[model samples]
Target: MGTQERKALEKQLRRSQILDAARMLLFSSGIDSVSISGISSKAELGVGTIYFYFKNKDEIFAALQEEGLALLYSKICKFIEKEPAPEKQLAGIAEAYYRVSEENKDYFDIINYFLSSPRIFFEPGLKYQIDMSGHKILKIIQNTIATGIETGVFKEAQPGRFSIMFWGTLHGLLHFKKLEHTILENENHRDLYEYSVNKLIDAIRCQ
Candidate 1:
Protein backbone atom coordinates (compact mmCIF):
# COMPACT_ATOMS: atom_id res chain seq x y z
CA MET A 1 0.00 0.00 0.00
CA GLY A 2 1.12 3.57 -0.71
CA THR A 3 2.25 5.54 2.37
CA GLN A 4 -0.29 8.37 1.87
CA GLU A 5 -3.15 5.90 1.28
CA ARG A 6 -2.31 4.10 4.52
CA LYS A 7 -2.31 7.37 6.48
CA ALA A 8 -5.67 8.41 4.98
CA LEU A 9 -7.22 5.04 5.80
CA GLU A 10 -5.91 5.21 9.35
CA LYS A 11 -7.34 8.70 9.81
CA GLN A 12 -10.73 7.54 8.60
CA LEU A 13 -10.64 4.59 10.98
CA ARG A 14 -9.86 6.79 13.96
CA ARG A 15 -12.70 9.17 13.07
CA SER A 16 -15.06 6.23 12.76
CA GLN A 17 -14.01 4.98 16.18
CA ILE A 18 -14.70 8.35 17.73
CA LEU A 19 -18.12 8.54 16.07
CA ASP A 20 -19.06 5.04 17.19
CA ALA A 21 -18.09 5.84 20.74
CA ALA A 22 -19.99 9.12 20.69
CA ARG A 23 -23.10 7.40 19.33
CA MET A 24 -23.08 4.86 22.14
CA LEU A 25 -22.61 7.56 24.77
CA LEU A 26 -25.29 9.77 23.29
CA PHE A 27 -27.83 6.96 23.22
CA SER A 28 -26.96 5.57 26.63
CA SER A 29 -26.53 8.86 28.45
CA GLY A 30 -28.55 11.35 26.45
CA ILE A 31 -27.09 14.12 24.27
CA ASP A 32 -26.84 16.57 27.16
CA SER A 33 -24.67 14.15 29.13
CA VAL A 34 -22.16 13.45 26.36
CA SER A 35 -18.75 15.04 26.78
CA ILE A 36 -15.24 14.87 25.34
CA SER A 37 -13.97 12.89 28.30
CA GLY A 38 -16.94 10.53 28.08
CA ILE A 39 -16.29 9.85 24.41
CA SER A 40 -12.57 9.46 24.97
CA SER A 41 -13.21 6.92 27.71
CA LYS A 42 -15.75 5.07 25.59
CA ALA A 43 -13.40 5.06 22.62
CA GLU A 44 -10.39 4.13 24.78
CA LEU A 45 -8.45 7.02 23.32
CA GLY A 46 -6.85 10.06 24.88
CA VAL A 47 -9.10 13.13 25.11
CA GLY A 48 -6.56 15.02 23.03
CA THR A 49 -6.85 12.41 20.29
CA ILE A 50 -10.61 12.89 20.08
CA TYR A 51 -10.09 16.65 19.83
CA PHE A 52 -8.02 16.08 16.71
CA TYR A 53 -11.09 14.63 14.96
CA PHE A 54 -14.05 16.62 16.41
CA LYS A 55 -14.26 20.04 18.00
CA ASN A 56 -16.99 19.20 20.52
CA LYS A 57 -19.76 16.78 21.44
CA ASP A 58 -22.19 18.65 19.22
CA GLU A 59 -19.93 18.21 16.23
CA ILE A 60 -19.60 14.49 16.86
CA PHE A 61 -23.33 14.08 17.37
CA ALA A 62 -23.97 16.08 14.22
CA ALA A 63 -21.81 13.67 12.24
CA LEU A 64 -23.64 10.73 13.75
CA GLN A 65 -27.01 12.34 12.95
CA GLU A 66 -25.87 12.83 9.36
CA GLU A 67 -25.20 9.11 9.11
CA GLY A 68 -28.73 8.41 10.31
CA LEU A 69 -30.18 10.71 7.68
CA ALA A 70 -28.04 9.08 5.04
CA LEU A 71 -29.49 5.71 6.04
CA LEU A 72 -33.04 7.01 5.53
CA TYR A 73 -32.12 8.58 2.19
CA SER A 74 -30.49 5.38 1.01
CA LYS A 75 -33.60 3.38 1.90
CA ILE A 76 -35.82 5.83 0.01
CA CYS A 77 -33.54 5.71 -3.00
CA LYS A 78 -33.55 1.92 -3.02
CA PHE A 79 -37.35 1.80 -2.93
CA ILE A 80 -37.64 4.45 -5.64
CA GLU A 81 -35.26 2.46 -7.85
CA LYS A 82 -37.64 -0.50 -7.83
CA GLU A 83 -40.78 1.54 -8.47
CA PRO A 84 -41.29 3.53 -11.69
CA ALA A 85 -44.77 4.96 -11.28
CA PRO A 86 -44.80 8.20 -9.25
CA GLU A 87 -47.78 7.16 -7.13
CA LYS A 88 -46.19 3.86 -6.33
CA GLN A 89 -42.91 5.57 -5.65
CA LEU A 90 -44.56 7.82 -3.12
CA ALA A 91 -46.11 4.86 -1.36
CA GLY A 92 -42.80 3.02 -1.40
CA ILE A 93 -41.01 6.03 0.02
CA ALA A 94 -43.54 6.36 2.85
CA GLU A 95 -43.23 2.66 3.71
CA ALA A 96 -39.46 2.90 3.55
CA TYR A 97 -39.54 5.87 5.94
CA TYR A 98 -41.52 3.96 8.53
CA ARG A 99 -39.53 0.78 7.98
CA VAL A 100 -36.29 2.60 8.74
CA SER A 101 -37.81 4.19 11.81
CA GLU A 102 -39.07 0.83 13.09
CA GLU A 103 -35.65 -0.74 12.50
CA ASN A 104 -33.52 2.16 13.81
CA LYS A 105 -35.55 3.91 16.47
CA ASP A 106 -32.49 5.40 18.12
CA TYR A 107 -31.19 6.77 14.86
CA PHE A 108 -34.63 8.19 14.16
CA ASP A 109 -34.59 9.94 17.53
CA ILE A 110 -31.20 11.46 16.72
CA ILE A 111 -32.60 12.81 13.47
CA ASN A 112 -35.66 14.27 15.24
CA TYR A 113 -33.41 15.80 17.86
CA PHE A 114 -31.49 17.78 15.28
CA LEU A 115 -34.57 18.63 13.26
CA SER A 116 -36.92 19.87 15.98
CA SER A 117 -34.29 21.92 17.75
CA PRO A 118 -34.75 25.69 17.44
CA ARG A 119 -31.04 26.27 16.86
CA ILE A 120 -31.18 24.85 13.33
CA PHE A 121 -34.19 26.99 12.47
CA PHE A 122 -32.61 30.18 13.84
CA GLU A 123 -29.20 29.78 12.24
CA PRO A 124 -29.27 29.84 8.45
CA GLY A 125 -25.74 28.60 7.65
CA LEU A 126 -25.80 25.89 10.30
CA LYS A 127 -29.22 24.82 9.14
CA TYR A 128 -28.03 24.55 5.54
CA GLN A 129 -25.04 22.38 6.31
CA ILE A 130 -26.84 20.19 8.82
CA ASP A 131 -29.91 19.84 6.62
CA MET A 132 -28.05 18.83 3.47
CA SER A 133 -28.66 15.14 4.07
CA GLY A 134 -32.34 15.78 4.75
CA HIS A 135 -32.51 17.87 1.59
CA LYS A 136 -31.38 14.85 -0.42
CA ILE A 137 -34.36 12.91 0.89
CA LEU A 138 -36.63 15.86 0.25
CA LYS A 139 -35.34 16.13 -3.32
CA ILE A 140 -36.51 12.60 -3.94
CA ILE A 141 -39.96 13.51 -2.67
CA GLN A 142 -40.02 16.66 -4.81
CA ASN A 143 -39.10 14.67 -7.90
CA THR A 144 -41.84 12.18 -7.24
CA ILE A 145 -44.37 14.97 -6.84
CA ALA A 146 -43.21 16.57 -10.06
CA THR A 147 -43.48 13.30 -11.87
CA GLY A 148 -46.98 12.78 -10.52
CA ILE A 149 -48.02 16.19 -11.74
CA GLU A 150 -46.59 15.51 -15.17
CA THR A 151 -48.32 12.16 -15.39
CA GLY A 152 -51.63 13.74 -14.33
CA VAL A 153 -51.76 11.54 -11.29
CA PHE A 154 -51.49 14.59 -9.02
CA LYS A 155 -52.94 18.04 -9.00
CA GLU A 156 -50.89 21.03 -10.13
CA ALA A 157 -48.88 22.40 -7.20
CA GLN A 158 -45.42 23.50 -6.16
CA PRO A 159 -43.40 20.38 -5.67
CA GLY A 160 -41.29 21.80 -2.87
CA ARG A 161 -44.26 22.92 -0.81
CA PHE A 162 -46.09 19.62 -1.19
CA SER A 163 -42.92 17.75 -0.38
CA ILE A 164 -42.80 19.57 2.96
CA MET A 165 -46.44 18.73 3.64
CA PHE A 166 -45.87 15.10 2.79
CA TRP A 167 -42.74 14.78 4.89
CA GLY A 168 -44.12 16.80 7.78
CA THR A 169 -47.22 14.62 8.02
CA LEU A 170 -45.19 11.43 8.13
CA HIS A 171 -42.86 12.90 10.72
CA GLY A 172 -45.80 14.01 12.85
CA LEU A 173 -47.22 10.50 12.83
CA LEU A 174 -43.87 9.02 13.71
CA HIS A 175 -43.46 11.61 16.43
CA PHE A 176 -46.69 10.50 18.06
CA LYS A 177 -45.36 6.97 18.37
CA LYS A 178 -42.06 8.25 19.75
CA LEU A 179 -43.88 10.24 22.42
CA GLU A 180 -45.76 7.07 23.45
CA HIS A 181 -49.07 8.65 22.60
CA THR A 182 -51.37 6.18 20.91
CA ILE A 183 -53.17 8.29 18.36
CA LEU A 184 -53.85 5.14 16.42
CA GLU A 185 -54.62 3.14 19.55
CA ASN A 186 -57.24 0.86 18.07
CA GLU A 187 -55.55 0.25 14.73
CA ASN A 188 -52.40 -1.77 14.17
CA HIS A 189 -49.40 0.61 14.15
CA ARG A 190 -48.36 -0.29 10.62
CA ASP A 191 -51.98 -0.01 9.52
CA LEU A 192 -52.06 3.61 10.69
CA TYR A 193 -48.91 4.33 8.73
CA GLU A 194 -50.43 2.96 5.55
CA TYR A 195 -53.63 4.84 6.25
CA SER A 196 -51.80 8.13 6.59
CA VAL A 197 -49.74 7.58 3.46
CA ASN A 198 -52.82 6.66 1.48
CA LYS A 199 -54.61 9.75 2.75
CA LEU A 200 -51.75 11.95 1.53
CA ILE A 201 -51.89 10.27 -1.85
CA ASP A 202 -55.62 10.78 -2.07
CA ALA A 203 -55.35 14.45 -1.18
CA ILE A 204 -52.81 15.04 -3.95
CA ARG A 205 -54.41 12.95 -6.62
CA CYS A 206 -56.07 14.61 -9.60
CA GLN A 207 -59.84 14.54 -9.14
Candidate 2:
Protein backbone atom coordinates (compact mmCIF):
# COMPACT_ATOMS: atom_id res chain seq x y z
CA MET A 1 0.00 0.00 0.00
CA GLY A 2 3.00 2.30 0.42
CA THR A 3 4.34 4.38 -2.47
CA GLN A 4 7.53 2.27 -2.63
CA GLU A 5 5.57 -1.02 -2.90
CA ARG A 6 3.39 0.42 -5.67
CA LYS A 7 6.47 1.50 -7.61
CA ALA A 8 8.06 -1.95 -7.29
CA LEU A 9 4.85 -3.63 -8.43
CA GLU A 10 4.69 -1.41 -11.51
CA LYS A 11 8.26 -2.31 -12.36
CA GLN A 12 7.51 -6.00 -12.07
CA LEU A 13 4.48 -5.66 -14.35
CA ARG A 14 6.53 -3.90 -17.02
CA ARG A 15 9.21 -6.60 -16.91
CA SER A 16 6.53 -9.27 -17.24
CA GLN A 17 5.23 -7.43 -20.28
CA ILE A 18 8.64 -7.74 -21.91
CA LEU A 19 8.80 -11.46 -21.19
CA ASP A 20 5.34 -12.02 -22.67
CA ALA A 21 6.24 -10.18 -25.85
CA ALA A 22 9.48 -12.10 -26.18
CA ARG A 23 7.63 -15.38 -25.72
CA MET A 24 5.18 -14.46 -28.48
CA LEU A 25 7.96 -13.76 -30.93
CA LEU A 26 9.91 -16.86 -29.99
CA PHE A 27 6.88 -19.03 -30.66
CA SER A 28 5.71 -17.23 -33.78
CA SER A 29 9.07 -17.13 -35.46
CA GLY A 30 12.00 -18.60 -33.57
CA ILE A 31 14.62 -17.60 -30.99
CA ASP A 32 17.15 -16.74 -33.70
CA SER A 33 15.29 -13.53 -34.48
CA VAL A 34 14.47 -12.29 -30.96
CA SER A 35 17.02 -9.60 -30.18
CA ILE A 36 17.02 -7.57 -26.94
CA SER A 37 16.01 -4.43 -28.74
CA GLY A 38 13.40 -6.39 -30.68
CA ILE A 39 11.74 -7.65 -27.51
CA SER A 40 11.81 -4.14 -26.04
CA SER A 41 10.09 -2.73 -29.10
CA LYS A 42 7.39 -5.41 -29.01
CA ALA A 43 6.93 -4.92 -25.28
CA GLU A 44 6.82 -1.11 -25.71
CA LEU A 45 9.60 -0.77 -23.13
CA GLY A 46 13.14 0.48 -23.46
CA VAL A 47 16.04 -1.89 -24.11
CA GLY A 48 17.64 -0.55 -20.96
CA THR A 49 14.47 -1.36 -19.02
CA ILE A 50 14.50 -4.95 -20.28
CA TYR A 51 18.16 -5.29 -19.33
CA PHE A 52 17.35 -3.89 -15.90
CA TYR A 53 15.04 -6.83 -15.24
CA PHE A 54 16.98 -9.51 -17.14
CA LYS A 55 20.74 -9.80 -17.43
CA ASN A 56 20.66 -11.22 -20.96
CA LYS A 57 18.75 -13.22 -23.51
CA ASP A 58 19.28 -16.40 -21.52
CA GLU A 59 17.57 -14.91 -18.51
CA ILE A 60 14.68 -13.74 -20.61
CA PHE A 61 14.21 -17.19 -22.14
CA ALA A 62 14.37 -18.87 -18.74
CA ALA A 63 11.68 -16.59 -17.37
CA LEU A 64 9.57 -17.29 -20.44
CA GLN A 65 9.93 -21.05 -19.85
CA GLU A 66 8.82 -20.64 -16.26
CA GLU A 67 5.77 -18.55 -17.09
CA GLY A 68 4.71 -20.43 -20.20
CA LEU A 69 5.05 -23.89 -18.66
CA ALA A 70 2.72 -22.85 -15.86
CA LEU A 71 0.06 -22.03 -18.44
CA LEU A 72 0.63 -25.36 -20.22
CA TYR A 73 0.55 -27.41 -17.02
CA SER A 74 -2.81 -25.84 -16.22
CA LYS A 75 -4.13 -26.76 -19.68
CA ILE A 76 -3.11 -30.39 -19.26
CA CYS A 77 -4.70 -30.60 -15.83
CA LYS A 78 -7.94 -29.07 -17.05
CA PHE A 79 -8.28 -31.28 -20.12
CA ILE A 80 -7.25 -34.53 -18.43
CA GLU A 81 -9.90 -34.09 -15.75
CA LYS A 82 -12.70 -33.98 -18.32
CA GLU A 83 -12.22 -37.67 -19.05
CA PRO A 84 -14.19 -40.20 -16.93
CA ALA A 85 -12.08 -43.35 -16.90
CA PRO A 86 -8.46 -44.40 -16.47
CA GLU A 87 -8.05 -45.46 -20.10
CA LYS A 88 -9.73 -42.32 -21.37
CA GLN A 89 -7.53 -40.40 -18.96
CA LEU A 90 -4.43 -41.79 -20.64
CA ALA A 91 -5.82 -40.91 -24.04
CA GLY A 92 -6.80 -37.50 -22.79
CA ILE A 93 -3.35 -36.83 -21.40
CA ALA A 94 -1.78 -37.71 -24.74
CA GLU A 95 -4.32 -35.59 -26.60
CA ALA A 96 -3.91 -32.76 -24.11
CA TYR A 97 -0.18 -32.84 -24.68
CA TYR A 98 -0.77 -32.31 -28.39
CA ARG A 99 -3.39 -29.64 -27.73
CA VAL A 100 -0.91 -27.68 -25.64
CA SER A 101 1.63 -27.82 -28.43
CA GLU A 102 -0.88 -26.67 -31.01
CA GLU A 103 -2.54 -24.07 -28.81
CA ASN A 104 0.61 -22.60 -27.32
CA LYS A 105 3.32 -23.55 -29.74
CA ASP A 106 5.52 -20.93 -28.08
CA TYR A 107 5.82 -22.92 -24.90
CA PHE A 108 6.24 -26.05 -26.97
CA ASP A 109 9.10 -24.43 -28.87
CA ILE A 110 10.76 -23.40 -25.61
CA ILE A 111 10.66 -27.02 -24.43
CA ASN A 112 11.89 -28.31 -27.77
CA TYR A 113 14.69 -25.73 -27.77
CA PHE A 114 16.76 -27.82 -25.42
CA LEU A 115 15.92 -30.94 -27.41
CA SER A 116 16.31 -29.63 -30.98
CA SER A 117 18.75 -26.77 -30.68
CA PRO A 118 20.98 -27.07 -27.63
CA ARG A 119 23.16 -24.01 -28.13
CA ILE A 120 21.06 -21.27 -26.50
CA PHE A 121 19.27 -23.28 -23.83
CA PHE A 122 21.55 -24.29 -20.97
CA GLU A 123 19.78 -23.35 -17.77
CA PRO A 124 19.80 -25.87 -14.92
CA GLY A 125 16.82 -24.38 -13.08
CA LEU A 126 14.73 -24.44 -16.22
CA LYS A 127 15.38 -28.14 -16.81
CA TYR A 128 14.88 -29.12 -13.19
CA GLN A 129 11.62 -27.26 -12.78
CA ILE A 130 10.23 -28.51 -16.08
CA ASP A 131 10.89 -32.17 -15.26
CA MET A 132 9.64 -31.83 -11.68
CA SER A 133 6.48 -30.04 -12.68
CA GLY A 134 5.94 -32.41 -15.59
CA HIS A 135 5.86 -35.31 -13.14
CA LYS A 136 2.10 -34.82 -12.87
CA ILE A 137 1.66 -35.97 -16.44
CA LEU A 138 3.86 -38.97 -15.73
CA LYS A 139 1.82 -39.73 -12.64
CA ILE A 140 -1.31 -39.74 -14.75
CA ILE A 141 0.30 -42.33 -16.96
CA GLN A 142 1.31 -44.49 -14.00
CA ASN A 143 -2.13 -44.26 -12.45
CA THR A 144 -3.85 -45.20 -15.70
CA ILE A 145 -1.67 -48.26 -16.07
CA ALA A 146 -2.21 -49.24 -12.45
CA THR A 147 -5.99 -48.94 -12.82
CA GLY A 148 -6.10 -50.96 -16.01
CA ILE A 149 -4.05 -53.72 -14.38
CA GLU A 150 -6.19 -53.75 -11.23
CA THR A 151 -9.58 -53.98 -12.95
CA GLY A 152 -8.39 -56.57 -15.47
CA VAL A 153 -9.05 -53.89 -18.06
CA PHE A 154 -5.30 -54.05 -18.41
CA LYS A 155 -3.87 -57.33 -17.05
CA GLU A 156 -0.46 -58.76 -16.34
CA ALA A 157 1.36 -55.73 -17.74
CA GLN A 158 4.55 -53.84 -17.04
CA PRO A 159 3.07 -50.58 -15.82
CA GLY A 160 6.41 -48.84 -15.48
CA ARG A 161 7.60 -49.95 -18.88
CA PHE A 162 4.25 -49.10 -20.45
CA SER A 163 4.41 -45.62 -18.97
CA ILE A 164 7.82 -44.94 -20.46
CA MET A 165 7.04 -46.52 -23.81
CA PHE A 166 3.74 -44.72 -24.24
CA TRP A 167 5.22 -41.34 -23.37
CA GLY A 168 8.28 -41.82 -25.56
CA THR A 169 6.22 -42.95 -28.52
CA LEU A 170 3.83 -40.02 -28.33
CA HIS A 171 6.59 -37.48 -27.79
CA GLY A 172 8.36 -38.64 -30.94
CA LEU A 173 5.14 -38.62 -32.93
CA LEU A 174 4.37 -35.06 -31.82
CA HIS A 175 7.89 -33.80 -32.36
CA PHE A 176 7.92 -34.97 -35.95
CA LYS A 177 4.33 -33.84 -36.45
CA LYS A 178 5.36 -30.30 -35.52
CA LEU A 179 8.63 -30.32 -37.42
CA GLU A 180 7.73 -31.36 -40.95
CA HIS A 181 5.72 -29.25 -43.38
CA THR A 182 4.59 -32.10 -45.61
CA ILE A 183 3.28 -33.99 -42.61
CA LEU A 184 0.61 -31.32 -42.44
CA GLU A 185 -1.73 -32.72 -45.09
CA ASN A 186 -1.59 -36.29 -43.93
CA GLU A 187 -5.10 -37.63 -43.35
CA ASN A 188 -3.98 -40.11 -40.74
CA HIS A 189 -2.45 -37.58 -38.37
CA ARG A 190 -5.35 -37.75 -35.96
CA ASP A 191 -5.71 -41.47 -36.42
CA LEU A 192 -2.02 -41.96 -35.88
CA TYR A 193 -2.22 -40.40 -32.44
CA GLU A 194 -5.20 -42.58 -31.51
CA TYR A 195 -3.58 -45.65 -32.99
CA SER A 196 -0.43 -44.99 -31.03
CA VAL A 197 -2.30 -44.84 -27.72
CA ASN A 198 -4.60 -47.72 -28.61
CA LYS A 199 -1.67 -49.91 -29.47
CA LEU A 200 -0.41 -49.63 -25.90
CA ILE A 201 -3.91 -49.80 -24.47
CA ASP A 202 -4.49 -53.03 -26.34
CA ALA A 203 -1.14 -54.38 -25.21
CA ILE A 204 -2.15 -54.03 -21.57
CA ARG A 205 -5.75 -55.22 -21.95
CA CYS A 206 -6.82 -58.68 -20.77
CA GLN A 207 -6.31 -61.05 -23.66
The TM-scores of all predictions, comma-separated, are: 0.87, 0.74
Stretches of model 1 off by over 4 angstroms after superposition: 1-10, 119-125, 178-183
| Runs off by more than 4 Å, candidate 2 | 1-16, 24-38, 117-120, 178-186
**Candidate 2 lDDT score relative to the true structure:** 0.75
Among these predictions, the greatest lDDT belongs to 1
| Candidate 1 residue-wise lDDT, 40-114, digit = tens | 999999999999987777678778878889989989999999999899999999988898888987778778877
**Which ten contiguous residues of candidate 2 have the minimum total lDDT?**
113-122
lDDT of 2 by residue, 23-48 (tens): 87887777778899889889998889
Model 1: ten consecutive residues of lowest lDDT: 118-127
Clashing pairs in 1: none
Alpha carbon lDDT of each predicted model: 0.85, 0.75
lDDT (0-100) at residue 162 of candidate 1? 90
